[model samples]
Target: MSNIPPAGMSAAEWQTRQELAACYRLAWHFRFTDLIYTHITARVPGEDGHFLINPYGLSWDEITASSLVKIDVDGNKVADSDYSVNPAGFTIHSAIHRTSHDAAWIMHTHTRAGVAVSSLEAGLLPLNQIALQFHGRIAYHDYEGIALDLGERERIVASLGDKPVLVLRNHGLLTTGATAASMFNTMFYMERACEIQVATLSMGQPLRKVPADVADHVATQYQSSMGEEDDVLLEWAAHLRLLEKIAPDYRD
Candidate 1:
């Protein structure tokens, strides 16, 4: 058993498509979607400069293994299909994928909690234990209109700077990982962290902040717990089981 499994395994393209489709279905199940607007993308297994994205205009729940669009880093479709991708949605993803191969999977969302946290001047405060897990690990990128410009990719990449999570300030949340399981786990926790932050702030009272050194220590503990065979995949497998029962058609 390998300590660190391959990122996006160089397995069959069908398997990659299946997991990518599962990512969409799980996002929909978890309400991480913005209609057909936001995107979740993955690097095509064994291929360079090509990726998979949900087709334009299909709600996240409607995404399927065969419906995902294969596109270049530039977001242009590379094969014949009934679907096409939203260029603007790919704008953020392409920047990271083009620059960081370690980020084989990326997720972006506009959930109310996520946006509320991002809109805060002090973003994603360490309000609790879960929130503390991200103390020194996340980055922020200022929202630049609607991510339609190619040149903004550079700045977005700079903001990311090898981090796995990026709060698109004044916009929403983003998470990256070498695998869909890892990325989705990050997205799930990141969203929950924002939800906790929002719930705490709504009280509108004096808040007790975690001492900075204690926060850093807890974050270090989290980082140490994750890399050994990635127990997050166990949670991801449980998610896949739930999806199988409720939305088996996603594997179509």
Candidate 2:
């Protein structure tokens, strides 16, 4: 599609599209994506019940700011675009965004490590600092085949509750935040935690659990360290710079 920003679009909405596009590109760069499978969606600024998601069939790296399709909570396109949205994939995201005011951005992935950890009977063990960040803030939703059925939306939302991270049992991982950067930040760590857990477990050696109290304390410490300035924004800025050096076309 056209790279130029659409006429009459607010500066805020345009920025949101760019940030979401950058998130997709970054996921591709970091190998967080599974071909064109997973989806990342951002709520349209100042627009209630609307979101921006990658067009169906586009590889994450092939996605651009202008290529993102705007759709309502029902997964119906709200804006004109050559590409169509993935209704099945949007079901998970739409369910969360519909129920949670804080879920301004939603990220889902099917990474190998994430899926491996999801299949475990004891999900996301507190094996390290990265995993500890989700000590009491993670939820698990049992897999129910593909997410094409709209009836599964309520169950997914119920399973997620108010947690920022959700480990789709035997499926993959999902993360939500009030900002695209924040969501991306959570996914980055969550994926790393899964990767570490899988690697550690593969050794078949006894694993040491970071004590519950310590995990709680560390989670609180991490939250305290995030002051007025948003860590995600800072991290996203650095990532954009890296993308500029490599794949700047995502901004198109």
Candidate 3:
């Protein structure tokens, strides 16, 4: 549990670090990784303006509880780490953490299908059930080149506007949750939604659009289903169990 030097924080942060690390490994096993480029970050418990992210130089699978880096909103390391942090990653994440009060964990990805649907003008259309889950719940930010510039953060925050999912046009997908597990759940389904949208659109058939009312119901169903105790506990426990079977050392 003590992969990095003691930062004088509580045990809650260590637990968050372990979960964030496992999320990285799960992302790797599930093919959500983009080499060492994308990130999944969690806010440090009891600390404002601070969050945990993967060490920049390591692949997702190589990340562990102790190897995660803690950095302030200013992109400065708050703890002693042998690895550097990525400026671009913080540029995107800090904007949300700085503004949205509920975004305890933020997951960003550049998956092939995710980028594919993001490139579409319709942007995750209600073409299928999976895609419908995000009807009216997805937010869009026009392409603004690489996200390294600090000025773009404000516009990004404006576009997010309290939505759970943000689709960066011509880029990729991002999800926010009050917990790491909820955040992972959003990305897992969001990526699937994108994949379904791309596949259905590629078929080039006349779309059988879901009725607007039905889409609304489905979307609301998804929203209402969130934060349920049994569902959250079971799904996250299963994911942890699977990770334990294959990559148990993430807890290090």
lDDT of 1 by residue, 1-252 (tens): 112223543445678888899999999988888998998999887789899999999999998887888899987788777887787878999998888999999999999999999998889898799888788889999878988999999999999997889999999999999888889989999999999888888899999999999998889888887544458878888998998899888877
Model 2: lDDT equals: 0.89
lDDT rank, highest first? 2, 3, 1
* Residue range with the least summed lDDT across 10 consecutive positions in model 1: 1-10
RMSDs, each prediction? 4.2, 2.2, 2.1
Candidate order by decreasing TM-score: 2, 3, 1
Overall lDDT per candidate, in order of appearance: 0.87, 0.89, 0.89
Tens digits of lDDT, candidate 3, 1-252: 344534675788888999899899999999999999989999998898999988998999999998999999899999889999888899999999888889999999999999998888887878777777678878999998999999999999999998989999999999999987888888998999877777787899998988899999987887688546568768988999999799899998
Off by over 4 Å in 1: 1-11, 226-228
Q: Which regions of candidate 2 fall more than 4 Å away from where they truly are?
A: 1-4, 226-229
List TM-score per model, in order. 0.94, 0.95, 0.94
Looking at model 3, which ten-residue stretch has the lowest summed lDDT? 1-10
Predicted structure 3: lDDT: 0.89
